[model samples]
Each structure stands twice: as C-alpha cells, then as structure tokens.
Target: MDGTTLYAVDGGIARITLNRPGARNALNDQMIGELLDALDRAKHDDGVRVIVLTGAGDRAFCAGADLDGLGRDGMGVNDVRDSAPFRLFTAFPALGKPIIARLAGHAVAGGLGLAAACDLVIAADDVKLATPEVNVGLWPMMIMAIINRNVAPKHAFKLYYTGSRITAAEGREIGLVTEVVPRADLDARVDELAGVIASKSPLGLRRGRDAFFAIEGRPLEDQVAYLLSELVELAGTEDAKEGITAFLENRPPDFRGR
Candidate 1:
C-alpha cells in the first residue's frame, strides 16, 4: 500500500492519490482495498482535517473498475457497490469531515460514483464525466444509486442510458460537480477550499454535516429535532470551547481534528 496509493499531508489537508496510472487508476481489487483502507485511515487520523482524492496522471481520476472488474472474475452491479463503488463513500458522511474529489481527468462509470459521493468536487473545465457503461451493454447501475441522491432522476437516467461524456462545466450544471477551473488551477483551488474548511471548527463541521444529510430525507419537525440533537452533541466537543474563546480574544483558533 505504501507506493501503490500515495498519501501526502500539507497543513491539515490530506491528499489520497490513486497510483495505478498505467491502468488509468482503475478499481482493481488491490486499488479498491487500498482506497477503502485509505478512507478509513483519513477519517481516524486527527491531522487529516479534509481529504482530496485524485489520480496519478492526466488521463483519469479513475476509469471506473479495471477492465478486469468487469469480466470473468469481474464485479456485478451489487458486488461493485459493496466492494468498491458508492459504499466506500457512503460510509463517509459519518466521518464528519469534508472529502473533496479533485477530478484532474476523466471520471466515468464507478469513477463518476467517486466524485458523486464526495462532500465536494472540483475539476478542470475539460475534465470528462460519464456513465459510459451502457455503451458496453451495462447500465450505470451502481453509480446510479448515488447519482440519484445527488442528481435529478431524469438527468441521471439520461447520463446512464446515453453513456455520453460531459465536460466538467456541464457536470456542474447537472449537479455532479462543485466548480470547474482551468487545468492549471485545479490544485490551488482545492487547496484554497481545504484551507477555508479548516478555518471552521471541525466539531461543528461534523455535527452540521451529519445533521444536513440526516434532515434531507426527513420532515421539517424531524429536521429540527436532528439539528437540535447535533447541537447538543457538538456542545461537548473541545472546538466549542476554543471557538468561543477565540471570538472573545479576537484571534484565530487552532483546530485539532478531534
């Protein structure tokens, strides 16, 4: 796992780079295992205030599962979800920290699932996004699960049934991306966002993020209850104390990603 998946930390930002450029960062079993493990590691590591997911080269953030994840020993739709697709990131909302997908290249099929599941996504204007599995006789079944959560049903169906690739700019319009920047500006933009995220109290960030998703599918009364519960839970965390003290002192508070 040491060289197969590169992990780097600068300030509070942890970057997870999928290292199989030769395979276009495809989700081979090893890559899948490593990504899950890396996400687990990123969540537990206090130094990691936010995570940035990217690939090793210019060709793909991921081309979805490897050519192998589709064939004889390949994953079926449900298997891909359980083994490597949306489940990996679906487990993420509980982490209470931001995970941003820095789409430096193409994100198709399950690769698009990666971007869809992230808390934020930023990509180059030229970055390609698609659920091209239909062209190969498979619909974007697993990817569709998350896609429906993030996108309109009709558009999600259009992406699945058509299998046409879209630019990152179009992805933003369709709710699949957060921002589209020039290729040269992708990293700086993600880094800037990471810094802004780090500026907030991590405890409140986690509470709010959890409440946000928890309330999304709930009624108004339930939403208020959930938010109130989150507030109570957050009041017990250290960041609350630091945040209040910092305001009183008129100085920046250093956060510990507790």
Candidate 2:
C-alpha cells in the first residue's frame, strides 16, 4: 500500500513490512505517511482481523529513523516529527486493533519504539533490540515514552543509558517480547498467532483492548468494581450471547464481530 512499507494479506492477517533494507529499513518520511495511512485503514477494515509488522530482508527489522540524509532535503530536528518512525509508535495506543510485531532482526532506536508499540511481539530468537541513540551523542528520549509502557522503568533506563544491545530472549525477560522463536520459525509463529486472533470476535477484542488500557494502573478495588460493571455492558452485546450459548452447548462460538 505504501512504497517503503509493504502490505499483504493471508486470510484475515495483514502483514506490513518495512522495505528499506538497504538503508537498514530506517523509517523515513515516505514510510511514515504510508504506515499511518495503512494502520488507520486496518483499524476500520473488518476484513483485517490481525496485523503483523516486520522489515524486509533479515539484517534489520528496522534500524530506527534514517539519519543519512538529515538536512539534505530540508529536514531538521523539528521536521523529524513527520518521519515515519516517530509517528508510528507515538500514536500507537490510538490504533484500535491488535498489532503483532514479527521482528526478524535488529530493532534499533526508532525501531525499538516500533517493537515496543505492538500489542504483542513475536521475535526471532537471535533478534537484537536496542536504543543506541545515546552512543551517537543523541538520546532515545522520545522513543523512551513508548518503551516505558511495556518494559520495567529500570530495565528501560539501563538499556537506554548503556546504549547496549540485548538479545531477543533478554528483551522477552524484560517484557518487550511476548515470544521468541528461531529465525526459521519467525514467520510461522507470527502466522500462528495471527490466525488465532483472526478466529476470535473482533468487536469483543477491540472493546476489551480499549477498556484494558483505560483500566491500567488504577486501584485494584476500583478496577475490580469497574470491571464488574463493564461485564454488564458486555452481557448486553449479541456476541456475548453467542459466547455464553456456545459455552453451554460445548461448541465454538460463531462471532460476527458485532
């Protein structure tokens, strides 16, 4: 759908690939616009139940924002807000659908933010994730916002401060990754999860997700009370009726994503 970002579908899964491998898939202006457009479309499209994001070629899922041509074409530090890497991850919570990151290689700087933005991430076992902006006399301060949400504050601080790279397993341990499989199994693992999501009820998934974040960090007593009330609303849905009936009948529920 976009030049720097590749889009494809298998069943209900929409796979969005970063295509600038030669540039280490660094996110540039073109890639950003395309990705935002694509994500917005996916959120509204009923045909797309799950979306998986990865980078083309194996060397890098994304190396972060492209720095090579900075100031070469009327771009400055301020102009960077329009860059794809910045826009993609920063506005992620607004994306109403589930995004699975299929990280095949290194995720650096802005790439790290993208990885952290996904609702879930299934990365290659050998994948390396880091935000090395400090090493270059810069800081991943912006990306750190997204990182702080998924990873422990201390862990996020340690990686950003040291500017050192960590393996996919370590990333998982620190909570940025949901699963890590061998390189050979990367696609298969992503596909498997995507299929699982595709089979479920989209409306229920979206509603639950929307409510999930709203409830985070709230007091346990308050959250529990809120959730209890929320269930009443869900029970009013047609999809919930099917789920309850299917459970009683001991059969899979046919969800229309209502």
Model number with the top lDDT: 2
Error of 2 at 22 (Å): 0.8
Candidate 1 lDDT over 92-182, as tens digits, reads 6776678899998899888899888898999988889999998989887666877888888888888988999988988898899999999
lDDT of all the models against the reference?
0.82, 0.84
Clashes of each: 0, 1
TM-score of 1: 0.89
Alpha-carbon lDDT of model 1? 0.82
Q: After superposition, how far is residue 151 of candidate 2 from its true place, in Å?
A: 1.7
TM-scores for all candidates: the values are 0.89, 0.91
